[model samples]
Target: MEFIDFFILAFSAVFLFLWWRTCFTKTKPKNLPPGPPGWPLVGNLFQVFLQRRHFIFLIPDLRKKYGPMFTMQMGQRTLVIITSPQLIHEALIQKGSAFASRPPDSPIRLVFSVGKCAVNSAEYGPLWRTLRRNFVTELMSPLRIKQCSWIREWAMENHMKRLQIENFEQGCVDVMEICRFTVCSILVCICFGAKLPETWIKDIDGVTKEVMLMTSPQLPDFLPILTPLFCKQMKKAKELRKRQLECLVPLIKNRRAYVEKGENPDSSMVSPVGAAYVDSLFGLEVPGRGHLNEEELVTLCSELFVAGIDTSTSVLQWAFLELVLNQEIQEKLYEEILEIVGKNGLITEDTVEKMSYLNAVVKETLRVHSPAHFTLAHAATEETELGGYKIPTNVNVEFYIEWMTEDPSLWKDPDVFRPERFLDGDGVNVDLTGTKGALKMLPFGAGRRTCPGLALGVLHVNLMLARMVQAFKWVPKPNEIPDPTETFAFTVVMKNPLKAVILPR
Candidate 1:
């Protein structure tokens, strides 16, 4: 038995080596981007595993050694990480269509993304367009968002009161937990078209987070050939997906019933009925795929919660941390808020636009601490050339967001947290939409695949920050400074969650 086991291991290793050499080396395309050479069979897969959670930290050193655009062979998967802003512009903006689609989802992702049916993971095509259009037109339109101001106001009031209560009772609030609930509360209303009880919302938040964490990149994600060995993990992922459906499918059914009756889903709230994402999907037909089934509806609605919650929560957490650390900046922002809207004025969506410094602060936060350190991997639709290198069809291209935002050549004093730069210097007339010219920074990404919720996301951050500043003075706890060291979750979050003292004005 021992001899047979050893023989099987040796044969498997030899087969993989020969397969790698035949497929990768012999059939390699000319002038693929330069990168660190890898071992015969495994390639850089071991290095990725070695770095573990800190793999993000290794990219900068690799960028310094290899040029801006480089490749890595992760078993059968080939990834090109692009750090040069010009090269990013060339690939994502200049030739956007060639790089519009997402790479194929892994097995775990297939369960969550429901076979690429969600907007974020769907391939670029008529199906993607139909879904994206339904989302933007029904939910994200300016009038629709404006109608939902009551939701934000409701969440903000509850959030501030909760924070005040917590600060009084426990002396410090858990910023991430409290802020996550508030963001989830707002998104829950938008996605389900109804307000749910706090406990119910919390349950939904927990399950969605579990799904997100489970779907993160794993060894089998990169090396599909080894998938059979990780049966337990795959099984766990399916269970989580089932749990997610259990939490979300009921909401989808409720919305469908409400739409069928032509009645408002949430009459208690003044926001327009039939504007919920689920409501819009009831009778909508994909060009080639006909009307979406219930599971697809649940998946798309789940995408809303998955996409908006963490990214917005992380930004709010980082913005407050920065405000707590930089007292002068905080004071300046408060003074501007007072001048524009008065001491006790509520920072509504309409009022938030009038505050230039407030907008600048959010922009600076996004630049310094982009919630997503890297854009979602984009796959090439066909063979293309970028930065004088050949990119073969279906290869994943990832842009390093932090590198571009912090590059010295792009912004003056790039490391400094100076919102004034946008008002006066190199960031002046900068376009967040990469359509104008060379890319400066992409917080929500660029081109056809750009986040449709870009405007809503910025508004959420700006409104939350302004109201927090107006209602209370944020300061670090006694002798400790707010630690801004980043750790990766679904989004880049503070390693040390911000714990601060909030004094009522």
Candidate 2:
């Protein structure tokens, strides 16, 4: 009995030693980055849980405590935050290949499925490259975009006409709704072949409008099961997804029909209107990437519309509000447009580039009203080291983009909406949004995934701005103060949504 007991004890000891070695051995991840300490399993998510809008106030505090790059745990996941340009450049631009992958987004899959159309959410692979290339070359290319100039002019013309109608006697206009509709019209024309089927058009527009609210920041992305168990938001998202899907599926079918006919879809394009983004993207297969099916095409279209609508519209509305609030800057931009572009019926792409002050105004608005507050999100594809710490595979990373843009260290007068700061304007460390240096201000985000539509967004903002300002002068509503208060349902939206009267300039 004694001999048997000894043998059994020895066996148990060996087994325990081996199990411990296997479980605790971490090779590549031993030296990632450092961050805030938190309780085991639960993480520092509680610190960010209930903000008026997803931790905006907490961001500055976090930056203070942890510096630009810090560590936090959200539920079972551990994450690293990158706050500076150098670090962001390293991860996104320099080591683009290894760190470019996204976290598992099974949730988005219920709405958007596989293939060439799902560029943003698609796994980092050839298919995504194909779609991106298509967008860059066929859609946003210089020649192709010029072809669609007529579409933009048409959309801008219609938008100005609507503003004329809504300007409360052409003195003040509802900047928020008007902006949303303007962006929606431009995106619609570019994406779904302009004159869409009735059901399709309504479907795309309704969903496009709702996208701003749908992507509202949630801490539960890291702990998704919690969303199913605790959040009512999932239910609402489901209902909205159904509404969007119904509208989009038909447009995909229509385009597929056009592609099936040997005729190039580009034939129907109206210059400066629907241009070749639609004209160029059809039935073409990427070399390594497979062709997109119906569902994929629909998802891509949906992404473009949603992404375009809120961000573009919000910036335009804010630009106008700044103009109304600061009549001086408004006049400055107007004078530049008048001097160079001549208050012409159309503000062409090149014409937009010439007005430097107008460019500053748009940049300033983006600076103060930075969208995608927590931008460097999702996961890493591989294990890597950032700032002397190991980032494990699939670990979620968060960057306080809005906070970084507004960081006093980066901007001289961060709170003040001064477009002049972007001019030959001088300050302590260069003004982040200044035209020459953009590394500091990540209004369009940073890295390989930095907004592909940056150039287009710039033109969109400027064109709409020049057209609206030249066509009508905005006035604050009588006895109603314009509220700069922002509540994030996505894109750091104006809490009250800028309300004003329009005066024809």
Candidate 3:
């Protein structure tokens, strides 16, 4: 009887120890940030997924409850949201190398990126560096941008002519749609070295939007085990890829053939002194990955077009919306443009720099209506401390650009649309790069992964806005006020498309 008692006691002790280890020791991290309590196995997925209409809207309330930096578990993935600009500077700029890599993509994103072949989604390594370097030196450099100035001018002319036609025919033009068409035309010209017909541009734009929608987070992304149940999404992704290839492959191949023959293509949009972006890609040879194949080339070009068109269009649309709402601000901008470039003068690259108020208007628009709510997710390469909180290796860190830009702590009257704030104050010398100090705003992001298209994007916005305000007077339609309510597509866009009357000045 004593022997049986001893065995029972030992077995009970062992079971208790195992239970404690599994339930307590292994469940929580030692120094994780404070966040809302979540359910077993799912974490905060349900709470987050429920707010899918505008998930970004929840951040402010979360910030109020959890403080500046906090954590949320999305199934098995840990997400750390950093809202403080100082902390953002520390993580994305000070310890940039530590958080330079990207987390694994959702299944649909994997397919859309063509196994991460495009520069934006490519892993941070030799391939990404090579691709980004190629883009900066060969395409986005000041000299290169100057070379491509005519493309923007030509695109603007087309945009103005179309606006006039639409205004005459319809009385009020859908500014959002016209902006998309104009931006896409410019990107198409740069990407393929030719001004494609409207039909081809519309086809590419349609496929691009479809692919972006499909790539948004789905059930299978958080629970990979459920991928088999999401085969329909996979099929749609493949179909989108096929449609994109059908439209893009022919252009890429034709450009490649032209370069291969050692003959400069007779395209009006191609720069006389340098190769087109597609031609530059044909010459690129990564360290491990050899020269890009046809499909890879197509993917890269498609990414360029989509990235350039979407965010710039959104920004320009917001600029117009704001200007129409605040006619006084619009008139001030018009006065500045007239003083610098004159009523009938062309707004060239050189002239754009001379328009300080125009620059301020663009800066203010970026601050108030940032195109993206979050920067592309950056993953910690190893366990580290951020804002004095422990961040585990492979954890996703997202910087909320909209929140940072509008943080009342940083800017005075952040909600108000005031361009003069950027003109005569501390913001007068605010640097977008965040190199000199803490970033006041990151419209193009900051650090090693800063957007390679910053100069081009800014130039496009400045010139387009200058010409539009100079060419016509923008007024809200009768009994219809311009609503700046935002909705998140791939880019955050105005919930209602901006529709207004454009009277030629």
Candidate 4:
């Protein structure tokens, strides 16, 4: 068929589908939570697409109109958005099982997820349990994390050297990009069992970034029937995934080879610190599956790499900016660090635990500038009810987590950057897991599906922030005030990247 003829045929089919659905199918789901009425067929599709970049920010306005629990129709998919803490607790905590599974991955996303095999993408079943259990116990346990402190220390040393060089030559440093590279370095060691060269790390980080951008919601994601329209885009996504595998597979093979020979991979680059994530996957057994293949290993490692690096980097960047803009806060944090660790003492994990003020600052940063605006899209395993409203199994349940942190009822001055808030009252002794106490803020989500890497993520932010402050006094560049305006780039980040002046302490 000619290209124009094919286009006309596709358009005709879509129009016919919409016309038939309007005439015969039910427009509104029964007993669904209140929401803005959607037009037939396309059904709020344009509204979501128009504000896709800032939709997380738009949830508050929708909550005002439709109450805490609201629903939106995106083509054939039903999205249930919960904004209130009570409803969030009721669904994810009170009835955790019904909502534990992840929503279905769009076809393109499955290419990266390797058919729902990664920890973050797996369904809540034997497979999910096994993956989560292995990851938490073998890879991210407190003991394992402590054993790998050398990796963080190595990355930290590299980070300081790079920043010192940049600050000396440029007068001001671009902290985000520098920190991203540093975090990538740390994760490469953890994921691959070796500290890769800067060039290799950048290539791996680069391909993962491209894959992440490609995996963001696309038109075919909402309506599978329209996938034909996105053939070119889908083709590009596959190519990116191939590039990602090419960058990572060699490291996986090398790690496996070293393990088979009973040797530590890249002994010169990495210490004999337990096993890397890839090392643990060699003989991993699933319920029906005996062991993971190379693609599955790559997928899981990629998940680990992507999950830890970007969010941690973004959080680190935000924490640094906050410190630079609020010198008093920075000094207070430094004083606490100085008292606990003393002058020139390494800010190890043990010392980090003793710095309550530093912990408060980290918590406050997470609350104020959560890297992700929403939890991974969750779904009902079966027909369910939330907040006295029906939740159909076909719907995707999305919690606007940023609103929870910003809710006035839960916080005093939600706009302020005051770590002191967490020093006392309801904020004190707050459980980040959100399984205990009230669900105030959960940047890593809550209940059964809470991020298994939560402990490691917090440690990364705290250690990096403490060391940065302890080593230097961060100040805004002479004529540059940090812009706190927010933007979404796979994660919530400062719209304007932070540039800071650093002085030796």
By TM-score, the best candidate is 4
lDDT of 1 by residue, 325-374 (tens): 89999999999999999998768989999999999999898889898878
The Cα RMSD in angstroms, rounded to one decimal, for candidate 2 relative to the true structure is: 8.1
Give the winner by lDDT: 2 or 4. 4
Task: Give a tens-digit lDDT track for model 2, residues 363-450.
Answer: 8888887766766364677777777677777676665666656667767878999888878663323433323444567776556566
User: Candidate 4, residue 252: CA error in Å?
Assistant: 0.8
Candidate 4 lDDT, 1-505, residue by residue in tens: 9999999988999879867876788555689887888776777888877775567778778888888888888887889998888888988899999999888899889998889998898988999999999899876777788878889998999999998999999998898889889888888888776877799989988887887889988777777778978899989988888888888888878777676765653563363534687777888897766799888888998898778888998998889888988889999999998999886989998999999999999999898889998999998888898888888877899988888888888888888999998888547877887889899999999989999999888888889898988999999999878999998888888899999989999
Of the two candidates 2 and 3, the one with more favorable TM-score, higher being better, is 3
Error of 2 at 122 (Å): 2.7
What ordering of candidates by lDDT runs from best to worst?
4, 1, 3, 2
**RMSD in angstroms, candidate 4?**
1.9
Per-residue error (Å), model 2, residue 470: 0.8
Kindly provide the TM-score of model 3 when superposed on the true structure, using C-alpha atoms: 0.92
| Residue pairs in collision within model 4 | none
